[model samples]
Target: MQEKNFITVDGKRFHYMWLRDNCLCPECRDPNSFQKIYDISEAQSPPKPVSVVEEDDKLTITWQEQPIHQSVFPISWLMAHVNELDTPVQSSRKIILWNKTDLQKERTVRHDFHNCDFDVWVNQLFSLGFTILENIKSTQELESFICSMGPIYETYYGRFIAFIIAMRYTLFFPSSLFPLPSSLFPAPKSLLRSPCSEVPKNQRFVPHGYKTCYIPVKPIKGTEAVDLAYSAVGHPLSPHTDFTYLNLGRLLQFIYCEENNASGGESIVVDGYRVARDFRQNHP
Candidate 1:
């Protein structure tokens, strides 16, 4: 790697562009929101720092072109953002793709939620696509915990219903793993089905308060679901993701299972990405 026109924080080296773009000064970024106001595209050429100085836990930079433009960044911030670099980056987290063989051979032991690190727990979820956690006391506790990470979004399903959350697990597989905390959601009043619950015919399942799109349960005479879209006898929809119809490329479905009651409608898992790759390479 080129050493010139670069700043090294702790042991990691960052390029001139990285320094210019991450200027923490009020002129470049909003002090309250911390959102960047400085446009990196404003620089036609690579940014050249006239002087780079490290004092206390902060690194300050002065650019020759702007003269007034100075960037002060905490060393701690630099370390945390080491991933945003021009060179090859290494992360402790890894993504491992699995097939049915691993599903049968491997098992996940539930982690104690009260004593677990959220950062490490999330890393594990991404690493293997799913993890089961235990000891989350109640719906209020779970909602509070989830809200800490980000805001809660209510769509076709309202805020944290037991039924919709449960159905999301069985229908969406081979994506991000959302293992239900051992003590999850309120005891479900309805089934874990879209339309998973008792609803009027043709009005698919929408949570109690949500007014959303509905899928016609009854098939059109000429149009039939070929690749396994339904559970009606004889259709036998194949193992596929339900989100495809919604045009979703990737989504994380978190289902907190209090318990499984209904029998026979088991979730069938399929490695869609692997299947697509195999089909392309072998067939073509």
Candidate 2:
């Protein structure tokens, strides 16, 4: 069923003007910047869809506006933002909460890269800040897979893969093919350092021009406190988020486990968003 000036997708109603205003077409938005060039406020009247067609998980709308505007919206995108006009008090996106017991049932968070579809991959990444891609063989395959999602952001260290969404989060791939000697291996760099210089201007140990840091969890014997202070090696790190300044505070990270011979390096993932919601409910 359809309402006047609105189209229904999967039983949810979305206004024609809302859909048109949020159109992601290159003509309406800049491809690189992803900023909207066409202002919805400028329109004399609300957009009207002359024809609506749903096929292959896509909603195509042909607008009745002069010059015959047409736009295609992904069913996934529409479903994700179903409550866009809802009261501002509610959270924008619904999150799935899980504990150790939930994790035992089946692998819901991780997906095999070879078998995953584009829509499924996008949904998982969007809903969860992190997703583990299994069975990725080589760097070439990783590059190809990331490029399919969106444009690659090349940095001083390596290519940074970023997706276009509310936040522009970047993915970094560190190569293990060319293993360097312990003496020659570069130290972990600080994200605050300037991109122009190799060393920070303050004469700190922090290295610059590197977007990603490689931390080897393998056990190492006997190291000076000075060296250990500056390095991520042999150091136990508590759970933390990265680079809140960039990409709207939500960074999508992918951790591919190429090899796992060492012990005591188990990964832990906690749904911070879910925890916050629970806390608010209990307290208030």
Candidate 3:
């Protein structure tokens, strides 16, 4: 039986496999990462759309197979990619950057907490990288509001990360023996430890409107050197985790070096839940 592609937006009909492959739904694509979980070639059979409907400038397609799935594509997305869809692969679109004036213009936006369109907030976050949200009642409210967008990706932090500031201000401190910033200064009860920084920056964020001065600690011999080259090339390097911003999370995978010239620490996979269970049984 021949299936016709009735999904049309902006006078452009998207290919079946392309639409299926680029499915923005949480199942086919990771809600957090935005990576495609659905692969076109390895599919058991070609993507066959049995039903297509267009509403509110979105095309929804239901596949003609078991383990039912649907793909939704926005009209704007289809219109922008009309030409690119025909190509083998397409380059990523450049990010939209803004200046201080652009941010000041947004200040006029009245944040009505009760009647909120989180979709607009999500769009603002995607385009501007960061959008200010205030007057959220509690962590529960925040979680519920956030989950309205997609599935929750549980963070490894001891508590919830309700707020995250995007801008990175790298501060170089002279102290070599400092503990990891998050562990050192814990976030107050519920809120996240603001500005999770990379290991390179040995300092926390100092907000503007405060005049501050720093006196560098005297360098001691046999201490870790603050050099990017040293971190990359130095053998038997200091103990540290990769992607420190992630803070020892469950997800990220360890990769083998492409050119294995020198040996690095073994990549250990530990089941966090299992470890916690054993610890509780033994200790309690």
Winner by lDDT: 1
lDDT of 2 by residue, 148-206 (tens): 65544423224422111110121111221111000111222222235622432223332
lDDT by residue for model 1 over 108-220, one digit each (tens)? 52578798877777876766666767876654565667667655544443555432212312221111112221111333333434554444444333333223344444432
Model 3 scores worst on lDDT over the 10 consecutive residues at: 172-181
Which structure is stronger by lDDT: 1 or 2? 1
TM-scores of the models, in the given order? 0.40, 0.41, 0.32
- Point out where model 3 deviates above 4 Å: 1-6, 84-284
Clashes of each: 5, 0, 0
Minimum summed lDDT over a 10-residue window in model 1 is located at 172-181
In the order shown, what is each candidate's alpha-carbon RMSD? Answer: 17.6, 18.8, 22.3
lDDT of 2: 0.50
C-alpha lDDT of residue 246 in model 3:
52
Give candidate 1 misplaced runs (Cα > 4 Å).
1-92, 103-117, 134-137, 162-237, 245-250, 280-284
Report clash pairs, candidate 2.
Answer: none
TM-score of 1: 0.40
